[model samples]
Target: MKRNSRLSLALHALSHMAFNTDQPHTSADIAAHAGTNPVVVRRVLGKLREAGLLTSERGHSGGWRLARAPRDITLADVYLALEESLVASPSETEQDMCSVEHALAIRVSTIMNDVEASLIERLSRTTIADVRHAAQ
Candidate 1:
């Protein structure tokens, strides 16, 4: 099971944006730094754009820029932008599964939900600028 890396990629791209240089960072540049393809970079960044965390431009000198200051964009913002499930739960066994199995699954699902909520709360405490500053 390959881990979905959209969350990390979005954060990485946002951190790069915090230190924008001569121009907005292009998808190609970001992909190169990430060691992935531009298409993948675009896919993850697209979500960031949709969430209003970043903005994109198209033209000879067009690229991506932060929609707001990095201080305003929390890690939770990126996580939510990607819309990924932090917890994975297996499907119910068989339709004829015993009551004990059903009960256990319900309890597990409840626990997972709580865990996901806690994760988002923790992420909210940090921002892209925070990470960028720490790196520098």
Candidate 2:
């Protein structure tokens, strides 16, 4: 399944942060590295901040940093923080459909839910530090 780009961006930023935990990383810096805009970086990282995975500071030397240790943050944590689904869920508008279609929709939805659960389960096994180490 194709996943959202925001998850890539978050993981990229976090993996880089894992290597350089001594100081904060600016959105501009991360955006440059990810080949995106600082505003886009802020929007994605903001969600991570809300999830308590990262912290931010303001001022000349201020930027973003991990709130917890890299080993403490799992891939699943970042995935859920972004709140995007890799699997396409069955549409709710299919409620007005016929019995066959409705039944198919229900079955599809159940399967999709299982797929997402399995994805999360797999992601939970890896931490940000694991990702960083893998890159080396």
- Can you give the lDDT of residue 11 in candidate 1? 84
Residues 77-132 of candidate 1 have per-residue lDDT tens digits of 99898988878875877586688888888899899989999999999999988998
Best-matching candidate per lDDT:
2
Q: Candidate 1: list runs displaced more than 4 Å.
A: 1-4, 93-96
Q: What TM-score number comes out for model 1?
A: 0.91
Judged by whole-model lDDT over C-alpha atoms, candidate 1 comes out at 0.87
Candidate 2 lDDT over 1-136, as tens digits, reads 2233999999999999999999999999999898999999999999999999999999999999999999999999999999999899977676588989899899999999999999999999999999999999
lDDT for residue 112 in candidate 1, whole number 0-100 = 91
TM-scores across all candidates? 0.91, 0.95
